[model samples]
Target: METATPFKLLLVDDDPQILLGLEKIISSHFSGDEILIFSCKNGLMASQLLASEPINAVITDIKMPLFSGIDLLKFMNEQNLACSSIVLSGYDDFNLVKNAMRLGASDYLLKPVDEGLLINALYELKKQSGQLPSFTRQTYSLTSILKMQQLLEGLIGSSDISLPDADDFEQEHHISGQTSCLMCYVDIRRALYSNYLTMFQFLTDRVESFLNSSREIPLLNPTVVYGRLDTYWIFLLFTDEASFEPEKILEPFLALLTKDHFKYSFTTAWYPYAHIRQADEECRKGFEKYYFDLPYAPSDAPANWQTLSESLDAAAAAAAAYDYASTIKNLELCFAMFNFLSPSISDVRKEMHHFVYSILNRNSAFIPIISTSKFTDYDLFEHIEKSESLSVLKKHLYSSVNYLIGELIESMENKDDYVIQKAKEYIHNNYQDNLTLNDVATHVFLSENYFSTLFSQKTGTTFRNYLRSFRIEKAKELLTTTNLRIYEVAQQTGYNEHSHFVRAFKAITGQSPGDYRQMKK
Candidate 1:
């Protein structure tokens, strides 16, 4: 491969992890001789590098502690450095993105950047800087997750994985004569299948992209595989660079993940590389110790966490029973415990999200009502993640729960009203025939007992009384309008016996049919 024309790129961010991540990706793409990359923790340091070094391009963040990315752009503009500038910012910083564009930034990208876009932008910048040669796009493709999973599991069971592709896999992904390896396992507390799928793919892609471009590990492509539920395992075979810190490389990418998906609690443990099986055992042991026996939990942590956990369960139970007040109270208690304990923000969000999941699982009918036609679970989860304090999280939680409960109650009332209206229509049309509470209830698709109680509650009268009153009114109309005899009138009004009909008419109107007909006529 011909050596590409020497190009210089400067990456600027206040975060060291950000700088490290960018450097690794860029270096993986261009050799040290082909593209020289410089990094700094702040805009001031970046400005110093630009002054001393003949930098051809610069990618900078918009916000920093003291001197912002905007200030760095101003310095570049004033100095008239012939450098291609690109700015990065969060979506909230759109105004700053525009300001960067106004200040002669050639392009801008949102934070949690798409690596493909970054690569393309760099390519364009390289072309503009007069690249006269070519570089190799050397990469390792993880063709099958299933195959990789089988190979790793096989390696765990025995000393050597005796698969047909073992030799080719070693040649493609492993460093030759590697004495040591670095292994990292990441676990995210996302319960839903859809959510875990997204998080897993995201972390996998980022690690793969970086490793694919990395030149140090030519012997082995890092092994990236799905571990147990909601976790990922990554193994890198590196040359004897004992000074190399894997945390420095991995932390930045994790930081990027948290920036975008703060609602999820992500835990990672590092292990010394031996063989695949040994490394797996070490990673699991370390992860369990780090996750379950965390130092942040004080001596009183068990009491507090247990209380919060119990409160979450209680809240879910209350919600399932449609006890809105109890559900809200228990939910508030959980948040209060979180406030007192002051657990990690990520853990708090994850637990609260799980509480919501529990409630929905128990009462799935409310799930659609909660998420659809309003602020969805995804939208509310974002709010929970971005909340600055426990109180803010409580506020968002209360809002979502309130909306869900309110809609549920209102829907129940509407359903009752509809059923009653249908029952009334059925009664009015069929009063001349024999009517029963069971018949009306069946017509409206409700149990007979429930319909009977609902009718009384809605109409302020028992079903039998309402039916009798309807029949009497029809009989009165017939006694006055038609010359029907008392017996004929009783038959027309759904009464089989004349004496019974006359007695009911007198009880209701204080007049027998004979006298009432005479008075009306």
Candidate 2:
């Protein structure tokens, strides 16, 4: 079954007793994916949460003081909030249910709601009413999505999908081995899907078709998605077929999906597993990052998306002009600005890729992205997005830029191609830390003088001058994007002497650091 999108669920009732019961039940079930649940003793407060938060469903008692549940229902309709509403009523309140139903309440539950009945009612509402939650750009990993689906299936009032012991959870409850289950994770690109549930139905039906065609008895491998997006699937693999690939289903699905409109493309991973319980611990373990990110609030710093965007555009211009220092500086500024937000590390993946894509996107008329990254199969965006912290993100970002620059320096002589590539990778990675020519020369297993000679011969500059230029460009980025003292910028870019740095800055750019910063400003 497709999981409910993370929603704001409001509980409104005058009686604390009923409010407590409903909270307990729903909290036990249907609350996750960062779902926010709020309870208020009156409609007045519930209405406020509805206004302030992204509420998708509301459960309200029919009669209450000040503002009654009926009044709340009427307000929802008047405002065109169109949220799914379940009315709670007494045995004597069927007359009120008549009014609530007329007012477009989804369904009514009697006082002291039965757990199974409430679940079944909500399930039917999702199916019949077509009131599934909407999508947020937030993307969860495939493992996280599946683990969440398992939790919704297992629990009644729990927020966590993880088990204390995977072995124990599996032992206590396990899928039978007789059923050939295949766990498939599908990544939905932004362009390929619009509504979540419809795409889900399409994939599930496709999987069932394969199962139905199976020569095995009782052969329909029931297919379902675990999350709101058709991102993860648990289905049966057919043994009768010589080979079974979900690609058969996906091929047709892709045919119908417009490729040009695709905002993001995804890879699919399928595995044959005997039982979910067998390796579920690993699945939950992989999802720990998602769980860790639950407490996230967007960075408090005001977003300057336009400024960050413009910097990347400038970096592209610099790259096209062979201003390696300026290109690196501009791109580094983009990463540095990213830190001000202090966003959840997992959330930054998409944003980081966006910036890297901005640079690579310019490769056609400028530096070719393939020649820069293809030799190493460096999926810079993927690596950067998966980083677990700001420090790592910065590290990945610079390494990618350096790799591109190193590749751009592909020599016609070819003698220093390998040596220069290795050297550039080292400098890009270690520039912000402690880096030296000896460190790089040792890394390439060449003597300092020999490596230095080859580098100079290929680039027409001594290694020292090139390294200095690279650091100065990097320092220029920090000068513009950060408020660090000039000395700090110098130190960060592998310069120690303040006077020496000043002279070098003036020598290369014909201006002091302060002057350069003003010019950029």
Cα lDDT, all candidates: 0.67, 0.60
Error of 2 at 308 (Å): 20
Give the Å error, residue 13, model 1: 24
Task: Report the lDDT tens digits of candidate 2 across residue range 1-521.
Answer: 98756556788988888788877776676656634678899998888777777677788998888889888988888888958888987644768988998998867776546564565455545554455544333344556655655643452113335454433444454433343343333333311222344445544444445444543433244333333323333332322222344445345433333221111122232333344443333332333233232223224333476666677677765554335788777766666565554455555566655555565564453235644454343556556645444544455456666656665655324646656765776776577666777888998899998998988887789887887788888988899999999898888887778888899899889999998998988
User: Residue-wise lDDT of candidate 1 within 413-456, one digit each (tens)?
Assistant: 57787577568767876887877889999998999999899999
Cα RMSD of all models vs. native, in order, equals 18.4, 22.6
How does residue 34 of candidate 2 score in lDDT? 38
The residue pairs found clashing in candidate 1 are 28-213, 173-220, 173-221, 174-219, 174-220, 175-219, 175-220
Where is the poorest 10-residue window by lDDT in model 1? 289-298
Specify the highest-TM-score model's number. Answer: 1
Off by over 4 Å in 1: 1-136, 139-162, 167-179, 186-233, 238-278, 281-314, 321-521
- Candidate 2 clashing pairs, residues 3+ apart or interchain: 28-156, 28-157, 29-156
How far off is residue 365 in model 2, in Å? 12
